[model samples]
Target: MGYSPSIYKFVEGSDTPVPLDMDVVRAVLSPYDIGDPNLTVMDDGRLQCWVRAADGSEAEIFVDEVGILVERPHSGPGVFAIVAELASRLGAAVLDPSSGVFFCSREAHACLPVDMRKDVIVIEMTGEGVRAALIG
Candidate 1:
């Protein structure tokens, strides 16, 4: 079987859908030291970034009103850790639809609610920004 893409959905607590602020996105990603940053606005309106991964691989990451998209994401454990860290920084949650795994920024895993049967996620855009939740 071909690889299934991993998706991260972002939402805000207040229910307002706001376009992701590129400045905040940049600040959140800066610590990763992604080399050769090339940012562009795609035809569909999403902001795309092409960067050099730590393992010397080329990676593409995109952001928009819906969420952040990672193309051909790394499957390493450190990648997940970085995801968790990013979730924490964004005050968001990361849900693995394929695996039904949920990572939260504000609380411990034990306290978060998850529905294993659901494969879709709904991101709530709050006044402060976004918070992720599982749906479908």
Candidate 2:
């Protein structure tokens, strides 16, 4: 019923590795049959995507060159899985901008440069739900 904070592709603030583009998005989501995803020409000019997580919950992601702009995160832990997958594949860490919480797939966390000992919240997806730790 309510909205979650906007998520972002981050590698320490605005220093993301590469600018995200529609072409790459299309490639990544191709397996899902999302089909030629394009940006909505609204004020934000974001590419909207509807993704269904393995658990059957769906989420709407609005992305641009800067990464996720607005998220209509429907609900459930599945949305986090969606974000983790994107982060892992994109080679970037996910950030909940408002909370300053960083997220990365467990598979990729060890390789991240987020100063894992800096005492920030980092979350990883687990089969049961999620795992959180105070690390940057």
Candidate 3:
């Protein structure tokens, strides 16, 4: 899935509004809790995630505070494991379809004193999942 920074404007006042920049968002979001290392941290400090679509296409997300890389037209094994790892790390949950499209939310993750629950929208991938979704 492709992300535009403007998607966050809807939740301007939400507790976990989406990140304005893709890089900052990845730095903040959480991941799932399965095994097999769905998400991985590169030696360069970048995060990688994988998402498999129903049509046999896969989405790979590479995120960092400085850049965001979303690759499409690929697929492999352990797609769910990658998503689960991302959810666990971000204290979030994922709803994915075998067709390859998926949604991720971190509202249930660790909440701070001023945080509220809201469905932060993001695509599930094999690399680092999301940036952040806040409560408006």
Best by lDDT: 2
What TM-score does model 3 achieve against the real structure?
0.30
Q: Model 1: per-residue lDDT, tens digit, 1-136?
A: 1122333434433333235556767765555546434456779987766544355433466777646765554444333344444455555545455555644534322223344213333333231122123222
Residue 126, candidate 2: how far off, in angstroms? 5.6
Candidate 3 lDDT over 1-136, as tens digits, reads 3331111211323444343354334443333212224367889876666545334445566666433344442333333344334444444434322223224444433231223223334444333343222101
Worst 10 residues of 1 by lDDT: 127-136
Off by over 4 Å in 3: 1-58, 66-77, 92-107, 110-136
lDDT of 2 by residue, 11-32 (tens): 4433344476556666654444
For candidate 2, list the clashing residue pairs, or say none. none
Candidate number with greatest TM-score = 2
- For every candidate in turn, the CA RMSD to the true structure comes to 8.3, 5.1, 10.6
Off by over 4 Å in 1: 1-19, 30-38, 108-136
Comparing candidate 1 with candidate 3, which one achieves the higher lDDT? 1
TM-score of each: 0.54, 0.58, 0.30
